[model samples]
Target: MKASELAALIGAELNGEDVEISSFSSIENISEGSLVAILGNKIPEDIYSSSAAAFLAKKGADVPAGKTYLFADDAELALVAAVNALYPKKHRDGVNPAAYVADSAIICENVFVDAFAYIGSRAKIGEGTEIHAGAVIGEDVEIGSGCIVYPNATIYDGCRLKDRVIVHSSAVIGGDGFGYYQKHGRNVKIPHIGSVILENDVEIGSGSCVDRGKFDNTVVGEGTKIDNQVQVAHNVKLGKHNILTGQAAIAGSSTTGDYVMIGARAGVSDHVNICSKVMLAAMAGVMSDIDKPGIYAGIPVTSRKGWMREIAYVRDLPNIVKRIKDLEKDKDA
Candidate 1:
């Protein structure tokens, strides 16, 4: 696409001569006929010197002389738009002969079941949904319209997924939760009888697992995006638009309010409540309820400010101990 055309597509303002862009690339790897976006406040010298054909920059960003520039309110967002326009996702339109769909399964119009995919008995696949090759939809599973279950993803029996949900490769939905009981010096397994409900627009990352409930549904609210390797335990309720980063784990029955952000490697203990807009910093360990919305960090999770202060004081402990010893010697003298 030409610079002016791309700018019009992204609703950006154009400056300098129009240039043809065939692809999108990073600044470091950009070549002629490729476009790149400048994300930082200042345009780097390397980016300015690169042989890129066009640039997507933030409004009011400085442009190199004679270089083509397209200005957007958010350069990163504009990059997403440019990439999508350059390479649109191709969806298969119909079921493949090699797919094993049960006779009782209800597949709606425009749904695509790829080769070797399995749709179980009484399963209902909504319109325009795509079940990629090697994916498995267990018995009685209900998947809504326009969803995509990527290759090798598995949705176990009786789980429900709303519209536009994306289950990345290797994701295990409705898997058994980690529950056990002590019995006569041995561990006994607890049965998870309930299902998982992934609301509209939710995306489960690759290698992530959302466990089924012990007696009721494990519900992930609408617009929530879970990162790779995350674990959502049985009966845990995640509110709308929450972001759980990679390696984060929520223990059984814990509930979080809308717009919560749990950083990477954070752990939330069972039965704890996280209020709306709460931000749990990386590696935070929450053992109790968070009643107020704010940034939290550290084990047993304190406010971010308090945690910083505690860290500072701990760093000065050795000096304080030495001073106390010197004072004792002076008194003795």
Candidate 2:
């Protein structure tokens, strides 16, 4: 695509001689024939030396001498639009001959079931959904339209995933929750009879697990994006648009309000309710309910101010001890 064509497609203004852009790249890794994103108001000094065919940048950004520029309100977003327009995804439909789909399973139109994929009894695959190779959709599972179950991903029995959901490779939805009871000095497993419900536009990252509920369904609210290796325990209700970063774990029965952001490796105790717009620092541990919305940090997370004060006190511990000893000696003398 030419720079002028891309600008027209992405609603960008062309500001230089139109150049043929065969591929897309970033400013850090500029290629000879690729269009690169040059963000921010001021152009970078190093960008002058880049060999990119065209620059995708903000409206007021200065274009490099003799180079084409596609100006947009938001360079990043426009770049995304340009990339999608330039490289469209290929749609693959129809069940593969080698796929194992039960006779009772309902496969919707425009859906694709790849080879080695398993669709159990009474499963209903929605239109425009793709069940990739090696994926397993258990009995009674209902996957909505435009969803993609990547290679080896599993949606256990009775689970329902809403429209536009993306389950990455190796993700296991509706797995058994970690619930046990002590019986005769041994651990007895509690059966998870309930399933998981992934709301619309929710994404389950690779290697993540969402445990099924014990009684009621474990629900992930709409637009929540969970990162890789995260864990959502049984009966936990995650609110809409929540961001659970990599390795974060929420214990069973916990509920979160909308827009809560749990940092990487953060831990939320069971039964705690986290209010909306609360942001936890990486590795922060929540022991109880967070009523107010604000930034929190540390193990057993406190307010950002409290965490900073604690850090300061710990840093002056040796001096504090020396001052205490000096006062004691003066009194004794």
Candidate 3:
């Protein structure tokens, strides 16, 4: 397609003459006839010298002179649009011959079950949903329309997923929660009978898990985006639009309000209640309820300001100890 045509299709403004774009690429490697996406704030120094058909970038981003550009207010959205237009998602509606779908399973219209995929007994595969190869839909599971269960993902028995939920490769939903009790001397395993509910528009990242509840459902609210390797423990309730970054974890029964963001590797302790609009920095350890909304940091998290103060004091600790020793010697003399 022409650069101007793609801009028109994606609701972006075209800044230069129309150029034929045959493919798409990141700013790292630009090839002729490829639509290069500039996601960073500053244009790469090599972009001007690179061979590229056109550019897709932020509306006000500086572009190399004489380059054809598609400028959007949001560059990420524009990239999604460009990718969708270039390589549209193909829906293969029929179940493959090698796929094993149980007799009691209800495979809806426009659904695709790839070879080696297993749709368990009594499972309802909704319309436009794709079960990729080696994916397993457990018995009695209810998957909603437009969902994508990627390769090797396992949806355990009795779990429910609402519309447009994307379970990426190797994600295991409805896994047994980490629940045990002390009995006599050895630890006794407790049975987790409850399921996990992934609400509409939620995306479970690759290798991530939402464990089953002890007695009630573990609910991830609508539009929450979980990053890779994240763990949402048993009975945890995450509010709408919460962003759980990579390696972040929520202990059992913990809850967070809407728009909460947990940075990479942050840990929320068990049963903690986090209020709306709170942001926890990377590697933060939240051990108690966060009643007020603000930026937080450090282990056993404090307010961002308090954490900064602690860092400053710790950096000066050696000097302070030497001064104290000198004062003691002077007094002895």
**1-333: candidate 2 lDDT, tens digit per residue:** 888888989999988788898898776677788887877555568876778788787888655567788889987789889999879889999999999999999999999999999999999999999999999999999999999999999999999999999999999999999999999999999999999999999999999999999999999999999999999999999999999999999999999999999999999999999999999999999999999999999988999999999999999999999999999999999
What is candidate 1's lDDT per residue for 1-333, written digit by digit as tens? Answer: 888888888888888788888998886688778888888665568776777888888998766677888889987788889898877788777999999999999999999999999999999999999999999999999999999999999999999999999999999999999999999999899999999999999999999999999999999999999999999999999999999999999999999999999999999999999999999999999999999989999998999999999999899999989999999999999
Tens-place lDDT digits, model 3, residues 218-283 = 999999999999999999999999999999999999999999999999999999999999999999
Ranked by lDDT, the better of candidates 2 and 3 is 3
Error of 3 at 242 (Å): 1.5
Q: Candidate 1 — which pairs collide?
A: none
Superposed model 3: Cα runs more than 4 Å off: 44-46, 60-65
| Candidate 2 worst ten-residue window by lDDT | 40-49
Question: What shift in Å separates residue 239 of candidate 2 from its native position after superposition?
Answer: 1.3
Query: Which runs of model 1 end up more than 4 angstroms from their true locations?
Result: 183-188
Clashing pairs in 3: none
Where model 2 places Cα greater than 4 Å from the true spot, the runs are 40-43, 62-66
Q: How many clashes (backbone N, Cα, C below 3 Å) per candidate?
A: 0, 0, 0
Better of 1 and 3 by TM-score: 1
